[model samples]
Target: MPDRDVRPVRVRLLEAAARLLADEGPRALTTRRLASEVGASTMVVYHHFGGMPELVRAVIVEGFARLAEHMAAVPRTADPVADLGRLALAYRANARANPHLYAVMFGGVPLDGQAPPAEEPVAGRAASGAGTFGVETFAAETFGVLVEAAARAMDAGRLRRDDPEHVSAQLWSAVHGFVMLELAGQFTGGAETVLTSMLVNLGVGLGDAPDAAARSLRAALDTPAP
Candidate 1:
């Protein structure tokens, strides 16, 4: 055969690298080793990814896409505050579901250092039939959601009339810090407990009365059995 193909080979190499990186740490990722692990020629990995740094970055991007898949799956509610809590819990669910990806994506990876290479969206988007959401872009979108929620609360005369940007930042920091720390194995309890605590803190800042947020939560919990 003149040549069966190399594109498939390159894709396999990337898949192998992703799996290994998920199972092993960054220290275990090497182009040569990855080639061996994938049963492909070293040239294939090098040709496909350019170099180790590029390959590592690709993995990081893929990991973020996976995280986005989990986040995107969180149900959007008519109640923005409830939507926020659901998103928070969904974040924890993603971490628990894919600890390996979570570890690499959030553990030691630096997303803000440099922009990721523009390439295919990755497995999650293709599988889910949805577009990829960059981490920063997603953060911005989530921030917008928080701002809308804050605005709603204020209009209802629940929350104080303050800067939505400031309140949004504060609330984002609270939820992100909690989830990030919990994923880093800093918390002792299960995700549900962590979620409860985070939602309570979020409510304090976003809801009129703590009870107002709590009632919404209680209703979610007692969603009609159908």
Candidate 2:
């Protein structure tokens, strides 16, 4: 028998497919191509994810799962607004770390049946059923993490009294927009400073007093990302 490769086949194959899709479009996701990228056999791809369709679905789900894991890992601090800030930072970091997967998760490459319109969705990958702006936030599972964080802030009288889902959508839009810009190499300033400013502005917009919002976001910026 040929010497078996011992690397994590599923992860390697999935990541390779995402990169192919992101870099070269969907047509690049051939079985042979994926195998060559991972230095594995086509058999490994079929065995691990069944077929291309299955692999595509797995890619979308895995993207959201990885994002959820990142959000979930953020330790909830006493300051809910600060916690929201941390989650926002985590969202950006996850996107930066997994640009290809992030593209697949968002509207960049439509693995799902939904066609991308002229303007791409900033709040993609929302798993939960978004109440008002249902289209934004593609993965609700991951967005739910954001909602919970924002709700904590709202409950603590940090944000305005309103729907957490809606609040999360607004916040997600800002964070996602920044990530998209950053990934596109359009950003030229300090990341933390930019993010902190955006969050502080959003905080005030969401009903936090200007001073309090600035203070909370300052704490958020000072705290380390998870």
Mind giving the per-residue lDDT tens digits that candidate 2 earns over 119-172?
235465322221222223336667888889888888899888899999999999
> Would you estimate the TM-scores of all the predictions?
0.64, 0.83
After superposing candidate 1 on the true structure, give the runs of residues whose Cα lies further than 4 Å from its correct spot: 1-25, 107-159, 162-165, 219-226
Question: How much lDDT does each candidate structure score?
Answer: 0.59, 0.77
Top TM-score hit: 2
- lDDT score, residue 85, model 1? 58
Supply the global lDDT for candidate 1.
0.59
| Runs with alpha carbons beyond 4 Å of true place in candidate 2 | 1-7, 110-138
Query: lDDT tens string, model 1, 1-226?
Result: 5755455564555556655666665566777788887677788776766777566555555556655666566555566566555555555566666555565555444333333455445344321112444444544554565577667656666667888888777876676677677767786768666667656656775545788787765654443211
